[model samples]
Target: MTDTPWLTVVRGTAPLLLSIPHTGTELADLESRLSSPWTARCDTDWWIEKLYDFASGLGATVVRTGISRTVIDLNRDPSGASLYPGQTTTGLCPTETFDGDDLYRHEEDKPDAAEIEERRRTYFDPYHAALQAEIDRLRATHDRIVLYDCHSIRSVLPRLFEGTLPVFNLGTNDGRSTDPALQEKVRGILADTGVSYVVNGRFKGGWITRRYGQPDKGVHALQMELACRGYMREPGDKASPENWPSEYEAAFATPIREKLLTILQSAIAWANG
Candidate 1:
Protein backbone atom coordinates (compact mmCIF):
# COMPACT_ATOMS: atom_id res chain seq x y z
CA MET A 1 0.00 0.00 0.00
CA THR A 2 1.12 3.53 -0.68
CA ASP A 3 2.30 5.04 2.61
CA THR A 4 0.91 8.45 1.84
CA PRO A 5 -2.59 9.31 0.61
CA TRP A 6 -2.61 10.61 -2.96
CA LEU A 7 -2.71 14.28 -1.91
CA THR A 8 -0.61 17.40 -2.35
CA VAL A 9 -0.25 19.87 0.50
CA VAL A 10 0.95 23.40 -0.14
CA ARG A 11 1.44 25.61 2.93
CA GLY A 12 0.92 29.36 2.62
CA THR A 13 1.29 32.55 4.62
CA ALA A 14 -2.39 33.49 4.47
CA PRO A 15 -5.01 32.17 6.90
CA LEU A 16 -6.98 30.41 4.16
CA LEU A 17 -7.41 26.71 3.38
CA LEU A 18 -8.18 25.85 -0.26
CA SER A 19 -9.53 22.34 -0.83
CA ILE A 20 -9.84 20.64 -4.23
CA PRO A 21 -11.97 17.58 -3.48
CA HIS A 22 -13.08 16.69 -7.00
CA THR A 23 -9.81 17.23 -8.86
CA GLY A 24 -8.57 13.67 -8.17
CA THR A 25 -8.24 11.00 -10.87
CA GLU A 26 -7.01 7.89 -9.04
CA LEU A 27 -9.48 4.98 -9.18
CA ALA A 28 -7.10 2.24 -7.99
CA ASP A 29 -9.03 -0.69 -6.47
CA LEU A 30 -12.33 0.90 -7.43
CA GLU A 31 -11.63 0.77 -11.18
CA SER A 32 -12.79 -2.79 -11.69
CA ARG A 33 -16.13 -2.13 -9.98
CA LEU A 34 -17.15 0.81 -12.18
CA SER A 35 -20.12 0.47 -14.52
CA SER A 36 -18.07 2.15 -17.16
CA PRO A 37 -14.56 3.49 -16.69
CA TRP A 38 -15.58 6.61 -18.63
CA THR A 39 -18.56 7.41 -16.39
CA ALA A 40 -16.40 7.00 -13.32
CA ARG A 41 -14.37 10.04 -14.41
CA CYS A 42 -17.27 12.06 -15.87
CA ASP A 43 -17.74 14.37 -12.89
CA THR A 44 -14.09 15.16 -12.19
CA ASP A 45 -13.10 18.75 -11.44
CA TRP A 46 -10.81 18.91 -14.47
CA TRP A 47 -7.79 21.22 -14.31
CA ILE A 48 -8.93 22.63 -10.99
CA GLU A 49 -5.60 21.97 -9.26
CA LYS A 50 -3.90 23.74 -12.18
CA LEU A 51 -6.46 26.56 -12.18
CA TYR A 52 -5.83 27.15 -8.50
CA ASP A 53 -2.10 26.48 -8.73
CA PHE A 54 -1.50 30.20 -8.41
CA ALA A 55 -2.81 30.17 -4.82
CA SER A 56 0.52 29.09 -3.35
CA GLY A 57 2.19 32.09 -4.98
CA LEU A 58 -0.38 34.30 -3.23
CA GLY A 59 0.44 32.62 0.10
CA ALA A 60 -2.84 30.63 0.27
CA THR A 61 -2.59 27.09 1.64
CA VAL A 62 -3.90 24.28 -0.60
CA VAL A 63 -5.10 20.75 0.32
CA ARG A 64 -6.15 18.46 -2.55
CA THR A 65 -7.62 14.94 -2.57
CA GLY A 66 -6.02 12.64 -5.12
CA ILE A 67 -8.52 9.75 -5.16
CA SER A 68 -11.46 9.92 -7.52
CA ARG A 69 -14.83 10.99 -6.10
CA THR A 70 -16.06 7.61 -7.40
CA VAL A 71 -14.41 6.00 -4.38
CA ILE A 72 -16.24 8.10 -1.82
CA ASP A 73 -17.06 11.77 -2.27
CA LEU A 74 -14.80 13.65 0.12
CA ASN A 75 -17.01 16.75 0.27
CA ARG A 76 -20.19 14.87 1.16
CA ASP A 77 -21.68 14.10 4.53
CA PRO A 78 -20.55 10.58 5.48
CA SER A 79 -24.02 9.79 6.85
CA GLY A 80 -25.24 9.69 3.21
CA ALA A 81 -27.38 12.82 3.57
CA SER A 82 -27.87 15.00 0.50
CA LEU A 83 -25.80 18.17 0.15
CA TYR A 84 -28.75 19.62 -1.75
CA PRO A 85 -31.81 17.94 -0.33
CA GLY A 86 -34.46 17.01 -2.94
CA GLN A 87 -31.88 17.81 -5.60
CA THR A 88 -29.97 15.61 -8.09
CA THR A 89 -26.45 15.36 -6.72
CA THR A 90 -24.70 12.08 -5.91
CA GLY A 91 -23.85 10.63 -2.49
CA LEU A 92 -20.79 9.95 -0.30
CA CYS A 93 -20.33 6.60 -2.00
CA PRO A 94 -22.37 7.11 -5.11
CA THR A 95 -24.06 4.10 -6.68
CA GLU A 96 -25.18 6.18 -9.63
CA THR A 97 -23.73 8.89 -11.79
CA PHE A 98 -25.29 12.34 -12.36
CA ASP A 99 -27.23 11.12 -15.44
CA GLY A 100 -29.07 8.52 -13.29
CA ASP A 101 -26.96 5.83 -14.89
CA ASP A 102 -25.78 2.92 -12.75
CA LEU A 103 -22.21 3.31 -11.58
CA TYR A 104 -21.80 -0.45 -11.46
CA ARG A 105 -22.96 -2.48 -14.47
CA HIS A 106 -24.61 -5.21 -12.41
CA GLU A 107 -26.45 -5.06 -9.12
CA GLU A 108 -24.15 -7.71 -7.73
CA ASP A 109 -21.16 -5.57 -8.58
CA LYS A 110 -22.44 -2.60 -6.61
CA PRO A 111 -20.82 -2.06 -3.25
CA ASP A 112 -22.83 -3.22 -0.30
CA ALA A 113 -23.35 -1.21 2.86
CA ALA A 114 -20.42 -2.94 4.53
CA GLU A 115 -18.26 -2.42 1.46
CA ILE A 116 -19.18 1.25 1.32
CA GLU A 117 -18.19 1.62 4.94
CA GLU A 118 -14.89 -0.06 4.20
CA ARG A 119 -14.18 2.43 1.43
CA ARG A 120 -14.96 5.21 3.87
CA ARG A 121 -12.63 3.79 6.52
CA THR A 122 -9.91 3.39 3.95
CA TYR A 123 -10.39 6.55 1.84
CA PHE A 124 -12.91 9.18 3.04
CA ASP A 125 -11.72 9.23 6.65
CA PRO A 126 -8.07 9.89 5.87
CA TYR A 127 -8.77 12.75 3.44
CA HIS A 128 -10.87 14.65 5.96
CA ALA A 129 -8.41 13.85 8.73
CA ALA A 130 -5.77 15.65 6.71
CA LEU A 131 -8.13 18.55 5.95
CA GLN A 132 -9.06 19.02 9.60
CA ALA A 133 -5.47 18.67 10.72
CA GLU A 134 -4.50 21.55 8.45
CA ILE A 135 -7.40 23.64 9.66
CA ASP A 136 -6.29 23.11 13.24
CA ARG A 137 -2.66 23.79 12.39
CA LEU A 138 -3.46 27.04 10.54
CA ARG A 139 -5.84 28.23 13.26
CA ALA A 140 -2.95 28.34 15.73
CA THR A 141 -1.09 30.96 13.69
CA HIS A 142 -4.03 33.18 12.67
CA ASP A 143 -7.07 34.61 14.38
CA ARG A 144 -9.36 33.33 11.63
CA ILE A 145 -9.19 30.71 8.84
CA VAL A 146 -11.28 30.67 5.69
CA LEU A 147 -11.93 27.27 4.16
CA TYR A 148 -12.36 27.65 0.40
CA ASP A 149 -13.81 24.46 -1.05
CA CYS A 150 -13.01 24.36 -4.80
CA HIS A 151 -14.89 22.33 -7.41
CA SER A 152 -16.05 22.31 -11.09
CA ILE A 153 -18.44 20.29 -13.22
CA ARG A 154 -19.72 20.23 -16.78
CA SER A 155 -21.38 23.53 -17.78
CA VAL A 156 -24.75 21.84 -18.08
CA LEU A 157 -25.70 18.54 -16.56
CA PRO A 158 -29.40 18.04 -17.18
CA ARG A 159 -29.60 15.83 -14.14
CA LEU A 160 -28.13 18.57 -11.91
CA PHE A 161 -29.43 21.89 -13.27
CA GLU A 162 -32.05 23.34 -15.61
CA GLY A 163 -30.13 25.81 -17.79
CA THR A 164 -26.45 26.42 -18.34
CA LEU A 165 -24.69 27.47 -15.13
CA PRO A 166 -22.77 30.71 -14.90
CA VAL A 167 -19.01 30.84 -15.13
CA PHE A 168 -18.68 31.43 -11.38
CA ASN A 169 -21.02 29.94 -8.75
CA LEU A 170 -20.14 31.28 -5.31
CA GLY A 171 -21.75 29.59 -2.33
CA THR A 172 -21.57 30.84 1.25
CA ASN A 173 -24.69 28.95 2.34
CA ASP A 174 -26.81 32.09 1.91
CA GLY A 175 -24.11 34.23 3.55
CA ARG A 176 -24.27 32.37 6.83
CA SER A 177 -20.86 30.77 6.40
CA THR A 178 -18.96 34.05 6.36
CA ASP A 179 -19.42 37.71 7.20
CA PRO A 180 -21.81 39.63 4.93
CA ALA A 181 -19.13 42.21 4.22
CA LEU A 182 -16.76 39.50 3.10
CA GLN A 183 -19.46 37.97 0.92
CA GLU A 184 -20.17 41.33 -0.65
CA LYS A 185 -16.52 41.97 -1.40
CA VAL A 186 -16.14 38.67 -3.23
CA ARG A 187 -19.42 39.16 -5.09
CA GLY A 188 -18.49 42.72 -5.94
CA ILE A 189 -15.22 41.58 -7.46
CA LEU A 190 -17.01 39.07 -9.68
CA ALA A 191 -19.63 41.62 -10.63
CA ASP A 192 -16.98 44.17 -11.57
CA THR A 193 -15.26 41.63 -13.78
CA GLY A 194 -18.36 41.27 -16.03
CA VAL A 195 -18.42 37.54 -15.43
CA SER A 196 -21.76 35.74 -15.10
CA TYR A 197 -22.32 34.65 -11.48
CA VAL A 198 -24.92 33.80 -8.84
CA VAL A 199 -24.78 33.77 -5.06
CA ASN A 200 -26.19 30.77 -3.10
CA GLY A 201 -28.10 29.52 -6.14
CA ARG A 202 -27.63 25.86 -7.01
CA PHE A 203 -24.62 25.13 -4.78
CA LYS A 204 -24.26 26.50 -1.31
CA GLY A 205 -21.10 25.14 0.32
CA GLY A 206 -20.83 21.42 1.03
CA TRP A 207 -19.96 19.34 4.13
CA ILE A 208 -16.62 21.06 4.67
CA THR A 209 -18.04 24.59 4.47
CA ARG A 210 -21.21 24.03 6.51
CA ARG A 211 -19.47 21.96 9.17
CA TYR A 212 -16.51 24.25 9.83
CA GLY A 213 -17.79 27.77 9.07
CA GLN A 214 -18.21 29.59 12.39
CA PRO A 215 -17.44 33.25 11.97
CA ASP A 216 -17.99 33.96 15.66
CA LYS A 217 -15.62 31.11 16.41
CA GLY A 218 -13.08 32.45 13.93
CA VAL A 219 -13.57 30.00 11.02
CA HIS A 220 -15.24 30.96 7.72
CA ALA A 221 -16.03 28.92 4.59
CA LEU A 222 -16.80 29.47 0.89
CA GLN A 223 -17.30 27.21 -2.10
CA MET A 224 -16.55 28.11 -5.71
CA GLU A 225 -18.11 25.83 -8.35
CA LEU A 226 -16.71 26.70 -11.76
CA ALA A 227 -18.40 25.73 -15.00
CA CYS A 228 -16.24 23.31 -17.03
CA ARG A 229 -16.86 25.22 -20.27
CA GLY A 230 -15.05 28.23 -18.86
CA TYR A 231 -11.77 26.33 -18.81
CA MET A 232 -12.06 23.49 -21.34
CA ARG A 233 -13.76 22.72 -24.64
CA GLU A 234 -16.06 19.81 -23.76
CA PRO A 235 -17.14 17.79 -26.80
CA GLY A 236 -20.66 18.52 -27.95
CA ASP A 237 -21.63 14.83 -28.15
CA LYS A 238 -19.95 12.34 -25.85
CA ALA A 239 -16.63 12.73 -24.08
CA SER A 240 -14.05 10.55 -25.73
CA PRO A 241 -11.66 8.69 -23.45
CA GLU A 242 -8.81 9.72 -25.75
CA ASN A 243 -9.43 13.50 -25.62
CA TRP A 244 -10.30 13.49 -21.91
CA PRO A 245 -8.67 16.79 -20.85
CA SER A 246 -10.75 18.33 -23.69
CA GLU A 247 -8.42 20.98 -25.03
CA TYR A 248 -8.25 23.62 -22.31
CA GLU A 249 -7.25 26.91 -23.95
CA ALA A 250 -5.22 29.29 -21.85
CA ALA A 251 -6.95 32.39 -23.31
CA PHE A 252 -10.45 31.65 -21.93
CA ALA A 253 -9.23 30.11 -18.67
CA THR A 254 -6.84 32.98 -17.90
CA PRO A 255 -9.56 35.48 -16.94
CA ILE A 256 -11.24 33.11 -14.52
CA ARG A 257 -7.83 32.39 -13.07
CA GLU A 258 -7.24 36.08 -12.38
CA LYS A 259 -10.65 36.44 -10.73
CA LEU A 260 -9.95 33.44 -8.51
CA LEU A 261 -6.71 35.03 -7.32
CA THR A 262 -8.56 38.21 -6.47
CA ILE A 263 -11.18 36.23 -4.57
CA LEU A 264 -8.50 34.37 -2.60
CA GLN A 265 -6.69 37.60 -1.83
CA SER A 266 -9.97 39.14 -0.73
CA ALA A 267 -10.72 36.10 1.43
CA ILE A 268 -7.37 36.37 3.18
CA ALA A 269 -8.09 40.00 3.95
CA TRP A 270 -11.42 38.97 5.41
CA ALA A 271 -9.71 36.41 7.60
CA ASN A 272 -7.23 38.96 8.93
CA GLY A 273 -10.08 41.32 9.75
Candidate 2:
Protein backbone atom coordinates (compact mmCIF):
# COMPACT_ATOMS: atom_id res chain seq x y z
CA MET A 1 0.00 0.00 0.00
CA THR A 2 3.00 2.34 -0.40
CA ASP A 3 2.48 5.51 -2.45
CA THR A 4 4.52 6.99 -5.28
CA PRO A 5 3.48 10.60 -5.96
CA TRP A 6 3.02 9.92 -9.67
CA LEU A 7 1.29 6.52 -9.40
CA THR A 8 -0.59 4.26 -6.96
CA VAL A 9 0.24 0.56 -6.67
CA VAL A 10 -2.55 -1.55 -5.17
CA ARG A 11 -0.94 -4.87 -4.34
CA GLY A 12 -3.10 -7.94 -4.98
CA THR A 13 -2.94 -11.72 -5.32
CA ALA A 14 -4.68 -12.33 -8.62
CA PRO A 15 -2.83 -13.16 -11.82
CA LEU A 16 -4.20 -9.95 -13.37
CA LEU A 17 -2.90 -6.36 -13.12
CA LEU A 18 -4.67 -3.08 -14.00
CA SER A 19 -2.96 0.01 -15.39
CA ILE A 20 -4.99 3.23 -15.14
CA PRO A 21 -2.85 5.63 -17.20
CA HIS A 22 -5.27 8.48 -17.87
CA THR A 23 -6.83 8.71 -14.41
CA GLY A 24 -4.21 11.18 -13.24
CA THR A 25 -5.02 14.85 -12.80
CA GLU A 26 -1.85 16.19 -11.12
CA LEU A 27 -0.41 18.61 -13.67
CA ALA A 28 3.30 19.34 -13.37
CA ASP A 29 4.34 22.87 -12.43
CA LEU A 30 5.82 23.45 -15.84
CA GLU A 31 2.68 22.08 -17.43
CA SER A 32 0.49 24.32 -15.28
CA ARG A 33 2.56 27.29 -16.47
CA LEU A 34 2.14 26.23 -20.09
CA SER A 35 -1.63 25.78 -20.32
CA SER A 36 -4.68 27.05 -18.57
CA PRO A 37 -5.92 24.73 -15.82
CA TRP A 38 -9.02 24.11 -17.91
CA THR A 39 -6.98 22.85 -20.85
CA ALA A 40 -5.09 20.53 -18.55
CA ARG A 41 -8.27 18.95 -17.16
CA CYS A 42 -10.03 18.71 -20.53
CA ASP A 43 -8.30 15.55 -21.71
CA THR A 44 -8.08 13.73 -18.40
CA ASP A 45 -9.47 10.24 -18.20
CA TRP A 46 -11.77 11.85 -15.64
CA TRP A 47 -12.37 9.68 -12.60
CA ILE A 48 -11.46 6.45 -14.33
CA GLU A 49 -9.59 5.27 -11.26
CA LYS A 50 -12.65 5.82 -9.08
CA LEU A 51 -14.85 4.06 -11.63
CA TYR A 52 -12.56 1.05 -11.65
CA ASP A 53 -11.47 1.12 -8.02
CA PHE A 54 -13.22 -2.20 -7.66
CA ALA A 55 -10.20 -3.83 -9.32
CA SER A 56 -8.57 -4.26 -5.92
CA GLY A 57 -11.67 -5.95 -4.51
CA LEU A 58 -11.64 -8.27 -7.52
CA GLY A 59 -8.11 -9.47 -6.62
CA ALA A 60 -6.31 -7.48 -9.33
CA THR A 61 -3.26 -5.31 -8.72
CA VAL A 62 -3.79 -1.66 -9.69
CA VAL A 63 -1.18 0.85 -10.92
CA ARG A 64 -2.42 4.42 -11.40
CA THR A 65 -0.83 7.82 -12.04
CA GLY A 66 -1.75 11.04 -10.23
CA ILE A 67 0.07 13.31 -12.70
CA SER A 68 -1.82 14.88 -15.54
CA ARG A 69 -1.52 13.62 -19.13
CA THR A 70 -0.60 17.13 -20.26
CA VAL A 71 2.64 16.65 -18.34
CA ILE A 72 3.63 13.50 -20.25
CA ASP A 73 1.18 10.88 -21.41
CA LEU A 74 2.11 7.60 -19.74
CA ASN A 75 0.29 5.80 -22.55
CA ARG A 76 2.08 7.42 -25.52
CA ASP A 77 5.49 6.13 -26.53
CA PRO A 78 8.45 8.05 -25.16
CA SER A 79 10.09 7.96 -28.59
CA GLY A 80 7.25 10.22 -29.76
CA ALA A 81 5.96 7.35 -31.86
CA SER A 82 2.41 7.60 -33.13
CA LEU A 83 -0.06 5.03 -31.78
CA TYR A 84 -2.33 5.76 -34.73
CA PRO A 85 -0.11 6.41 -37.70
CA GLY A 86 -1.69 8.35 -40.61
CA GLN A 87 -4.33 9.55 -38.16
CA THR A 88 -4.63 12.44 -35.75
CA THR A 89 -3.29 11.51 -32.30
CA THR A 90 -1.61 13.08 -29.33
CA GLY A 91 2.03 12.50 -28.40
CA LEU A 92 3.86 11.60 -25.18
CA CYS A 93 3.57 15.30 -24.48
CA PRO A 94 0.78 16.94 -26.40
CA THR A 95 0.73 20.60 -27.35
CA GLU A 96 -2.87 20.59 -28.43
CA THR A 97 -6.17 19.01 -27.44
CA PHE A 98 -7.77 16.12 -29.34
CA ASP A 99 -9.87 18.73 -31.11
CA GLY A 100 -6.87 20.34 -32.89
CA ASP A 101 -7.06 23.33 -30.60
CA ASP A 102 -3.93 24.71 -29.02
CA LEU A 103 -3.66 23.87 -25.35
CA TYR A 104 -1.33 26.72 -24.70
CA ARG A 105 -1.78 30.33 -25.69
CA HIS A 106 1.78 30.48 -27.06
CA GLU A 107 3.60 27.74 -28.94
CA GLU A 108 6.74 28.68 -27.06
CA ASP A 109 4.91 27.81 -23.86
CA LYS A 110 4.93 24.16 -24.80
CA PRO A 111 7.54 21.79 -23.46
CA ASP A 112 10.76 21.94 -25.41
CA ALA A 113 12.67 18.73 -26.12
CA ALA A 114 14.78 19.16 -23.02
CA GLU A 115 11.74 19.96 -20.89
CA ILE A 116 9.76 17.07 -22.29
CA GLU A 117 12.67 14.77 -21.59
CA GLU A 118 12.91 16.19 -18.11
CA ARG A 119 9.24 15.50 -17.50
CA ARG A 120 9.75 11.97 -18.82
CA ARG A 121 12.68 11.45 -16.55
CA THR A 122 10.79 12.88 -13.60
CA TYR A 123 7.29 11.42 -14.10
CA PHE A 124 6.87 8.88 -16.90
CA ASP A 125 9.96 6.81 -16.17
CA PRO A 126 9.08 6.22 -12.51
CA TYR A 127 5.49 5.26 -13.35
CA HIS A 128 6.61 2.66 -15.88
CA ALA A 129 9.33 1.44 -13.57
CA ALA A 130 6.67 0.72 -10.99
CA LEU A 131 4.48 -0.95 -13.62
CA GLN A 132 7.31 -3.08 -14.97
CA ALA A 133 8.31 -4.11 -11.48
CA GLU A 134 4.73 -5.05 -10.64
CA ILE A 135 4.43 -7.13 -13.80
CA ASP A 136 7.63 -8.95 -13.01
CA ARG A 137 6.46 -9.69 -9.47
CA LEU A 138 3.00 -10.88 -10.56
CA ARG A 139 4.50 -13.07 -13.26
CA ALA A 140 6.58 -14.85 -10.65
CA THR A 141 3.47 -15.66 -8.58
CA HIS A 142 0.80 -16.25 -11.23
CA ASP A 143 0.76 -18.50 -14.26
CA ARG A 144 0.10 -15.39 -16.38
CA ILE A 145 -0.28 -11.61 -16.06
CA VAL A 146 -2.83 -9.35 -17.70
CA LEU A 147 -2.19 -5.60 -17.93
CA TYR A 148 -5.62 -3.94 -18.33
CA ASP A 149 -4.90 -0.37 -19.39
CA CYS A 150 -7.93 1.76 -18.45
CA HIS A 151 -8.76 4.96 -20.28
CA SER A 152 -11.65 7.30 -21.27
CA ILE A 153 -12.20 10.25 -23.58
CA ARG A 154 -14.90 12.34 -25.20
CA SER A 155 -16.82 10.07 -27.58
CA VAL A 156 -16.65 12.49 -30.51
CA LEU A 157 -13.59 14.56 -31.19
CA PRO A 158 -13.46 15.49 -34.85
CA ARG A 159 -9.76 16.29 -34.49
CA LEU A 160 -9.00 12.80 -33.22
CA PHE A 161 -11.65 10.73 -35.03
CA GLU A 162 -14.08 11.28 -37.87
CA GLY A 163 -17.14 10.06 -35.96
CA THR A 164 -18.13 8.96 -32.49
CA LEU A 165 -15.90 6.21 -31.13
CA PRO A 166 -17.64 3.08 -29.99
CA VAL A 167 -18.40 2.95 -26.26
CA PHE A 168 -15.71 0.37 -25.68
CA ASN A 169 -12.72 0.79 -27.98
CA LEU A 170 -10.53 -2.28 -27.46
CA GLY A 171 -7.01 -2.30 -28.83
CA THR A 172 -4.34 -5.04 -28.95
CA ASN A 173 -2.35 -3.98 -32.02
CA ASP A 174 -4.47 -6.33 -34.21
CA GLY A 175 -3.59 -9.33 -31.99
CA ARG A 176 0.17 -8.84 -31.89
CA SER A 177 0.17 -7.71 -28.23
CA THR A 178 -1.87 -10.50 -26.64
CA ASP A 179 -3.05 -14.05 -27.05
CA PRO A 180 -5.87 -14.69 -29.55
CA ALA A 181 -7.88 -16.55 -26.95
CA LEU A 182 -7.37 -13.82 -24.40
CA GLN A 183 -8.36 -11.20 -26.95
CA GLU A 184 -11.42 -13.16 -27.99
CA LYS A 185 -12.43 -13.72 -24.38
CA VAL A 186 -12.46 -9.99 -23.71
CA ARG A 187 -14.28 -9.28 -26.95
CA GLY A 188 -16.87 -11.90 -26.06
CA ILE A 189 -17.55 -10.27 -22.70
CA LEU A 190 -17.86 -6.81 -24.21
CA ALA A 191 -19.99 -8.20 -27.02
CA ASP A 192 -22.42 -9.86 -24.62
CA THR A 193 -22.82 -6.60 -22.74
CA GLY A 194 -24.33 -5.10 -25.90
CA VAL A 195 -22.47 -1.88 -25.20
CA SER A 196 -21.27 -0.86 -28.67
CA TYR A 197 -17.67 -1.96 -28.94
CA VAL A 198 -15.05 -2.58 -31.62
CA VAL A 199 -11.88 -4.66 -31.59
CA ASN A 200 -8.50 -3.22 -32.68
CA GLY A 201 -10.62 -0.25 -33.52
CA ARG A 202 -9.72 3.37 -32.82
CA PHE A 203 -7.57 2.44 -29.76
CA LYS A 204 -5.60 -0.77 -29.58
CA GLY A 205 -3.68 -0.27 -26.40
CA GLY A 206 -0.90 2.28 -25.91
CA TRP A 207 2.82 2.15 -25.11
CA ILE A 208 2.31 0.27 -21.86
CA THR A 209 0.13 -2.42 -23.47
CA ARG A 210 2.22 -2.67 -26.65
CA ARG A 211 5.51 -2.73 -24.79
CA TYR A 212 4.64 -5.06 -21.90
CA GLY A 213 2.10 -7.46 -23.46
CA GLN A 214 4.47 -10.37 -24.13
CA PRO A 215 2.36 -13.48 -24.47
CA ASP A 216 5.47 -15.61 -24.82
CA LYS A 217 6.56 -14.47 -21.34
CA GLY A 218 3.09 -15.13 -19.97
CA VAL A 219 2.41 -11.39 -19.73
CA HIS A 220 -0.61 -10.19 -21.73
CA ALA A 221 -1.73 -6.55 -22.11
CA LEU A 222 -5.06 -5.03 -23.16
CA GLN A 223 -6.23 -1.41 -23.39
CA MET A 224 -9.84 -0.25 -23.09
CA GLU A 225 -10.67 3.37 -24.11
CA LEU A 226 -14.21 4.23 -23.03
CA ALA A 227 -16.11 7.20 -24.36
CA CYS A 228 -16.85 9.82 -21.67
CA ARG A 229 -20.41 10.15 -22.89
CA GLY A 230 -20.99 6.54 -21.88
CA TYR A 231 -21.03 7.82 -18.28
CA MET A 232 -20.84 11.62 -18.39
CA ARG A 233 -22.26 14.61 -20.20
CA GLU A 234 -19.78 15.32 -23.01
CA PRO A 235 -22.22 17.41 -24.98
CA GLY A 236 -21.97 18.51 -28.62
CA ASP A 237 -21.31 22.06 -27.48
CA LYS A 238 -17.77 23.36 -27.47
CA ALA A 239 -15.86 21.63 -24.63
CA SER A 240 -15.24 24.31 -22.03
CA PRO A 241 -14.37 24.81 -18.37
CA GLU A 242 -17.94 25.32 -17.23
CA ASN A 243 -19.84 22.46 -18.87
CA TRP A 244 -17.49 19.55 -18.15
CA PRO A 245 -17.09 19.18 -14.42
CA SER A 246 -14.92 16.27 -13.29
CA GLU A 247 -17.44 14.38 -11.20
CA TYR A 248 -19.44 11.16 -11.61
CA GLU A 249 -21.85 9.46 -9.19
CA ALA A 250 -21.10 5.83 -8.40
CA ALA A 251 -24.74 4.93 -9.02
CA PHE A 252 -24.40 6.42 -12.51
CA ALA A 253 -21.04 4.74 -13.16
CA THR A 254 -21.82 1.30 -11.69
CA PRO A 255 -22.87 -0.55 -14.83
CA ILE A 256 -19.84 0.54 -16.89
CA ARG A 257 -17.66 -0.36 -13.91
CA GLU A 258 -19.18 -3.82 -13.74
CA LYS A 259 -18.57 -4.37 -17.45
CA LEU A 260 -14.90 -3.38 -17.05
CA LEU A 261 -14.33 -5.78 -14.16
CA THR A 262 -16.15 -8.47 -16.08
CA ILE A 263 -13.69 -8.05 -18.95
CA LEU A 264 -10.69 -8.21 -16.60
CA GLN A 265 -11.90 -11.31 -14.77
CA SER A 266 -12.81 -13.08 -18.00
CA ALA A 267 -9.41 -12.26 -19.48
CA ILE A 268 -7.60 -13.48 -16.38
CA ALA A 269 -9.59 -16.71 -16.23
CA TRP A 270 -8.98 -17.37 -19.93
CA ALA A 271 -5.28 -16.66 -19.50
CA ASN A 272 -5.06 -19.18 -16.66
CA GLY A 273 -6.79 -21.82 -18.73
Give the Å shift of residue 265 in candidate 2. 1.9
Q: Estimate each model's TM-score.
A: 0.94, 0.95
Q: Which candidate wins on TM-score?
A: 2
Could you give me the TM-score of model 1 versus the true structure? 0.94
lDDT, model 1? 0.83
Q: State each candidate's clash count.
A: 0, 1
Query: Least lDDT summed over 10 consecutive residues: which range in candidate 2?
Result: 26-35
Q: Candidate 2's residue-wise lDDT over 110-169, tens digit each?
A: 779999899999888988998999998988888787888888889878877777889999
Local distance difference test, each candidate: 0.83, 0.83
Residue-by-residue lDDT tens digits, candidate 1, 1-273: 113668777777689889888988888677777877788887789889888888888788788878899888998999988888888888888888776778787888877899889989987888788778888888999998889999987777788899889988999988888878888998999899897898999988899888878888777888999888777887675455775658567787898888888899888888887
Off by over 4 Å in 1: 1-5, 238-244
